[model samples]
Target chain A: MALLILPIIIPFATAILSLLFRRSAAAQRAISLLGATALLGAAIALLNVVWSDGIQATQMGDWPAPFGITLVADAFSAIMVTLAALTLLATVVYSLADIDVRREAFGYYPLLNVMVMGICGAFLTGDIFNLYVWFEVLLIASFVLMALDGDQAQMKGAIKYVVINLIASTLFLVAAGLLYGLAGTLNMADLAVKLRDVARPDLVATVAMLFLIVFGIKAAVFPLFFWLPDSYPTPPAAISAIFAGLLTKVGVYALIRVFTLIFVQDVAYTHTLILVIAGLTMVAGVLGALAQTEFRRVLSFLIVSQVGYAVMGLGLYTSGALAASVFYIIEDVVALQCLFLVSGVVYRLNRSENISVMGGIYRTYPGIALLFLIPALSLAGFPPLSGFFGKLALLQSGLAVEQYAIVATALVVAALTLFCIGRVWSDAFLKPSPAPGSAGVLVRSAALSSSRAQMIGMLIPVVVLVALVIGIGLLAEPVFGLATRAAEQLWSPSDYIQVVLGEAL
Target chain B: METILAFVVGGLFAAGLYMMMRRSIVKLIIGLALLSHGVNLLIFTAANLTRANPPIVPDGAKQPLPPVADPLPQALILTAIVISFAVLSFALVLLHRVYQAVGTDDIDRLKPVDE
Candidate 1:
């Protein structure tokens, strides 16, 4: 019980302490780092406990099952919690050097910690309404973080982000209300059990559609992804890295949770629709990435595109497919974040975000070029990398299910992703730097660091993440094994219901 | 009362969506506010309103008496109200900052981040 809530508590404590120490940048950074480390420790503990013990559930104030709010960690929830914690730690490490003092003084660390709390809480909660609240918690924190710098681009992007996400939250609230009205319960496990017996299948399907729309918007699927690319790249790279890494994945997680556990009755209709959306999202996202000349913008489009792969796993709705989705998310989170931080380094060095204006990175900074190449190739699904295994699992599962159309689309998108990545590499790294007085150079070159210490501080997270991605790739078998176990738990909703509701239901 | 409120809720939804469709940034925020109100009312209506007593336990009673209004939706609404209020205020403040930064109330005039 105590273990389940530690992830949330540690971050909240850290955020308050940091906010109190906001006047002193050093104190705030130290407090934030300590809080993040504590969070990672708590998350790993929860994961270990869940791995050894079947599933863990704790009711708030001992109110018991359906009557009280519950925090439950099944295999899937535990893995997500651990992944979120890991990403939070990496983002904090990167922010040490990437973030400016002005932003740091303006409560950046506090907001980041609070956002992590919301993320961990979202992953741990067993109640549907609690999940909605957690989403709002993270959304609010992200809104401030997105606009923390208060620049023109940031403000414009923030408005679009704020408005669209608010609309999605409102819709999510409506869906929660309607589900409660139908089932007379807010507890997700209990609702799942009760919804199975509800006589009005059509009404339930209507509510399911409402949920799909809500999560779809949140997940940045197909036509609903405009706000994502518009807003994500405008934030500082550390902020963008976390957002790119976790936010939409949370939406995908919610979609998977609800669809598998509660909305399984109409899989023929809903899952097929999801598969169609997945195909379009892949094609559209990669095409958008191919069109972009900006560094982070290309990566932003890839986030949208990569989500399609995860959603495709959900659409396939098999244990293998679900496991593939989980693997894809874990690998993509690590690789994409590494890419974003590398983009930050590149921007710092070249003093430009436009790939057309940036050049000679490979010639000038071989190590940075290598850092970019690893994740870039991984994201492009090259062999002997984490992404290759993720794509292989997804493709194999898609083939086993005989989803030929989506399978073909996935293959085509893979090729396009490679081309897009190759284009970025050629323009941003391989091309020789334009002559000193050339029109292509928008700004003079800026050194990544004036001192060795600052450079190492910035490089540590990027290097660690690169190693982690490589580790995930080399140890794909064990990681995929864990994912398969998580998928099994998701495949069998009865286990979740039993653990969450117990004898009370 | 439910019937009338249903129509009122529908009216709010329509008006909110209409307002949101306009190009003005302030109108969009107002529309968001209206939309949330509509959702709250919908929750209340969907939970089945009653003219019965409030859900308070009487002396020597362990649970709320039967023939009382459902209290859960009210609790849910209270939470919804707080969250939406916080979000709305933040949105308004964002609106203010955006206007100051961009020198316009027209959302259409705002450029894309890449631009």
Candidate 2:
């Protein structure tokens, strides 16, 4: 339990230190790196502890449950925190070379550290209202990061991003307020216990529905997802990669935690809505990807599509399905970050994100192309990749539930994902250079100069992430076992509530 | 009283949504402000609108008491108000920057090349 809290505390303290030493770029970088590395260590230690000791919980300030905020670390949150720590560490390394270190010294490292703290806190928090505070922490950090450059594209994207999220935050607050009003407590565990015994069950259902809306907007579900594609690609690659890899997953994690614990009975209605949304999200996202001619835009759209798979697993509501959803979330985050990193390298090489202006790069940068291809293929659900296993698990669960239409739609969408990625691969790597007339129109071709060090910095992380994806694919049984345990824990609700509110409650 | 508050907040919410859907950046900011107000009110109303006294205990009060406003909701709303103000100011600066860079407040005009 003590180890579990370190991920949140280390980043938070480092954020303050970084701000205090904001005038010195070197100090800021050192503090940020030290903080991130410490968090990585803490996450590993916590994972090891959980592996040995089952689950861990800590009551803040030594207060009993229903009165104090609690931090709980189970298998699901532990894995997520570990992944988030690793991703932030990689992004920090990438930012060292990518960002203007001196100009960004005051705000960049501090905000990033705070964002990581927010993500870790959200993952670990056991109280519903405290989760809202964590969400605000994440949001405020992200708002600053998105507008970091103050460029036209970033400013436009930031406006839409902030507005949409503010609305979602408002909805979340309303839902939390209602839940507290009804249950007479804001702790998630106590609410879960009280909710199960409530006489006015309809009110609980209504609040749950509102929560779904709030989290759905954050998670970028179908109708609520329009802002994502427009906004994500405009930011700097490191910021975009972290946002792509971790932010929405936090929302999905919240959905899984809340619905599975407190709103199980409403699943019949909610899961159906989720199923419909999943199918549409998958299809619409891939269609958007297909229509895109730019590398980053395509990846952004694909993120929408990939998130559908995680939601699909949850919507199916079987134990197998929920486990698969967890697996999908992990794989998607790793694979998506790899893709974005590779896209950054590609943009650096070609001087543009437009696929039309890129060709024959494989001749000069075969290693980078290979790195990009791994995640791209994995994303398409290719055999022997982590993405394949995630989708297969989802398909099996959907079939078991006799959701034939969803299964069929998923198959088609998977094929479309492959085709879209293949289009990118062919245009950006395999094809000959464009004709001279077309080549002349390309902007700043001089920017295509590639450095071995930059490629190494980018490619190493991509290769390691892809390798992990493949490893997870091969070791699906054990991974699935962990996810199954998590899903079972989610379904039971008793251990979580008891740990937070005491067994007597 | 609760139903009327809901109706008013819902109306504000709908107006905010409509304004947010517009392409004008200024309207979007106004919309967000309205929406936050509506949400704050919604959270306030969720606590059932207490009257007669503040949540603070009087000097002569005993261990237990009734007819007091829920302090939790008030605290949450206060925090939310601070957060929304920060976000609103940030949005205002961002909008100002966007206007200068793109020379237009229309979102449609500011579309990036890759978009």
Candidate 3:
């Protein structure tokens, strides 16, 4: 029980401490790093417990499941929490070098801790309403972080991001309310049980659709994702890294949870809708990236596209498909974080984010060039890297289910993704410096201003994350086994509910 | 009475959607407020209505009587309302920030950095 709650508590406590010490950058960084290390350790411990003991669960205040809030961790939630804690650890280290003292003084670490708490809470909560509250917590924190500098572009992005996200939240509230009206419980396990016997199946399905739309906005699916490209690129690279890496995947996680757990009665219609959305999301997102000249904007659109691969896994709805989705999320999160971190370094080197203006990073900083290629190639589904296996699993699942159209879309999108990523490689790395604004000369001069400490701070996280991406690719079987277990639990929730509420409670 | 309130909720939803589609940020916020209230009432009415007695167990009963309103949805709405209020206040402050930085409330004029 303590194990189940520690991931949430550690971050919450760290957030408070970080806030109290906000005025001193050194103290704040110390608290934040200590908090992140502890969180990662707690998450790993919790993962071990859940793996050995089976789904660990505890109800708050001794209240039973339907009447009281429960915190539960099956393999999937534990894995997500672990992923988040790992991301937080990497980000905090990166922030030490990347965040200006101004933003750090402006409550960055505290808000970051709050966001971490919110994310972990969302993953661990056994109640639907509780999940919504956690979503709001992380979101409000992200809002402040995105607009931290109050630059014109950041402000514009923050406005669209906030407004659209608020609508998504309101929709989630309405859906949760209506679901409660239709069924008598908010506990996910109880709802899964109650919803099976509900008299009105169609109404339940409509509520499911409402959930689909709500999470879809957050996942940045096609036709609903215009706000993402506009907003994501405007934040600082580290802030962008965290948002890009973790936030959208939470939406995907919720979609997988609700569809797999509560509203499985009409998978035929709903799953197909998801498949259709996944196809369009892939096509539109990659095509959108093709038009973007700025490095971050291209990456932003690429995030939308890659999200489709995971959603496609859910759309397929088989155990293999869901397992593939989980694996895909792990690879994508690390890759996206690395890509954004590299983008920041690229900005430091070239003095711009425009690919047209960037040249000769390969000649000047081969290490940074290699770092960029690791994620860029992984994101495009290159061979023997983490993304290759991630995409292979997804494609295999799609083929098994005969989702031919989406499978085709995935392939076409993959090729186009390479094309777009290739655009960056040629412009930023391989090409000689453009005649008038020679990037090599500019970078050499700026190296004086860009302190070596800052460079190490940025590069350390990239190295750690890239090593992870390679490790996941090399050690695919153990990770894949874990994902298989997670999918099985999602498919069959009896163990989950009984663990949470007890056998007879 | 339930039908009348349902219509009122529908009307608010319509107005909210209309306002949100406009170019100005302030109207967009007002629209959000209206949408939230509409959804809250929708929850209230959808959970089934009762006025005969409070949803409390009597002196010796283990459970409230069937005709008593379900207290769960009411509690859900209360939580929803508070969350929406918190978010609404945040959205308003964000709007003011955007306006200060961009010098415009119109959404169209705010696209200075985009392609």
- RMSD (Cα, Å) for all candidates, in order, is 1.5, 2.4, 2.4
User: What is the C-alpha local distance difference test score of each model?
Assistant: 0.90, 0.84, 0.89
Q: How would you encode candidate 3's per-residue C-alpha lDDT over A120-233 as one tens digit per residue?
A: 999999999999999999999998998897678888889889989989998998898788878978899899888988899999999999999999999999789999999998
DockQ of 3: 0.73
lDDT of 2 at A30: 87
Q: Ten residues in a row with the worst lDDT in model 3 chain A?
A: A439-448
Q: Give the range of the ten consecutive residues with the poorest summed lDDT in model 3 chain B.
A: B106-115
Note the residue pairs that clash in candidate 1. none
Put the candidates in lDDT order, highest first: 1, 3, 2
Model 2: fnat (fraction of native contacts): 0.63
**Tens-digit lDDT track of model 1 for B1-115:** 9999899899999999999999999999999999999999999988887888788988998977777888899999999999999999999988999999888989888878434
Candidate 1 Cα errors over 4 Å, as ranges: A440-450, B113-115
Clashing residue pairs in candidate 2 are: none
Per-residue C-alpha lDDT of model 2 across residues A1-505, encoded as one tens digit per residue: 5786899999999999989988888888888889889999999888777766766889899888787889998878888999999898878887765666533754899899899999999999998888998999999899888878666677778777887898888889889888877887888877777887798889988998899899999999898888898889877787888999999899899988887877876678988888898899999999999999878889999999998888998789888888889989988998998788778777787777779878877887787788888888888899998899889989999999999999999999999999999999999988876665574344533434446776676666667777887898888788888778777777676777766676548
DockQ per candidate, 2 decimals: 0.79, 0.60, 0.73
Is 2 or 3 the stronger prediction by TM-score? 3
Candidate 2 vs candidate 3: which has greater lDDT?
3
Interface RMSD (Å), every candidate: 1.0, 1.8, 1.3
